[model samples]
Target: MPRPNVWRDSAETTRLWVFDALAGFPLILMLLHLRWWTFGVAVTCFVVFGVLERMGYSVRFALRRLRAIAGGSVKLGQPWWGKRQERL
Candidate 1:
């Protein structure tokens, strides 16, 4: 059977955020030591990234999508990458 969606499960989503927080904590701390304003920026960036992750968005995926669009390979309402006959 196909597995249930992780985002649909509250426990799984919470776990995902927790791990993200753990990974971001050190970066946030470093920013705080550098400057108070930097700390705020770091926290804001982390939160934005966290929300995007929760929404199933990936920066790498977006970059590839943009590349595909620039390459004139992808059309509107279609995937930018995957099983392509031509190289991107």
Candidate 2:
């Protein structure tokens, strides 16, 4: 049998935000303590989220979907780095 859609089960809905915060808190702490590696830390966080979800979507894609359901200003397929000011 296929794995149940644990992510969508109503029982799991509340836990999702809880888990998100739990993961983010450590990253926030590290960012506050370390003044360097800002980009590296952010990329690490995105990878962590994608790994945690174990979904096929890219980190940005996953966040796009999550934001869509949660209501946010982000557009789909936008890179985790946000909009491009200039392409070289």
Candidate 3:
């Protein structure tokens, strides 16, 4: 059984709700408590998560193209946070 595309998958839909809850819960709390600090924290956290999610999608897109180029044979690359940083 092959996996479905992200757009057609329940997993992605569930993730969307989870992410929304992460940001929305903080927002609602901030509003109810009238805390300006939480507003800042919530906005910052939301932005960070948004950036991370975009990075994840970008990496997946890149890997998909690479798999197509390699005839569906794909190998994982070294972790970006590995001990030794590459000198590009």
Candidate 4:
């Protein structure tokens, strides 16, 4: 699924919520019909799963930036930390 522009950064935005709802609708309904407690647990699992995923992405991004710096690849924020972006 494509990430829409408006909801790219927010977890509670209507677009993101709606997309998650539609994607999980069948599983949600099935779990809810099976057992109330199980349905609650499943919803919690899905929401927190995304939180963990976002956290991991951020860590990976930082590591990538550090690796680039160490390799002397210049970037806007770290221009002083490495060689300038250039062509011979």
Error of 2 at 54 (Å): 2.8
Candidate 4 per-residue C-alpha lDDT over 47-67 given as tens digits, one digit per residue, 9 for 90 to 100:
654564466533234447669
- Candidate 2's C-alpha runs over 4 A off are 1-19, 55-88
In the range 43-83, model 3's lDDT, one tens digit per residue, is: 88667666756666432454467678987567667886876
How much lDDT does each candidate structure score?
A: 0.62, 0.61, 0.63, 0.56
Candidate 2: tens digits of C-alpha lDDT, residues 1-88: 8987766766432333434444464467677777557657765875677586675434446667787889867655878589768878
Which candidate would rank higher by TM-score, 1 or 4?
A: 1
Tens-digit lDDT string for candidate 1 (1-88):
9998877766432333454544365465766589877677676766766676678865445447768878896565746675457877
Residue 17's C-alpha lDDT in candidate 2?
45
Q: Pick the candidate with the highest TM-score.
A: 3
- lDDT order of candidates, best first? 3, 1, 2, 4
**Poorest lDDT segment (10 consecutive residues) of candidate 4:** 13-22
Q: What TM-score does model 1 achieve against the real structure?
A: 0.37
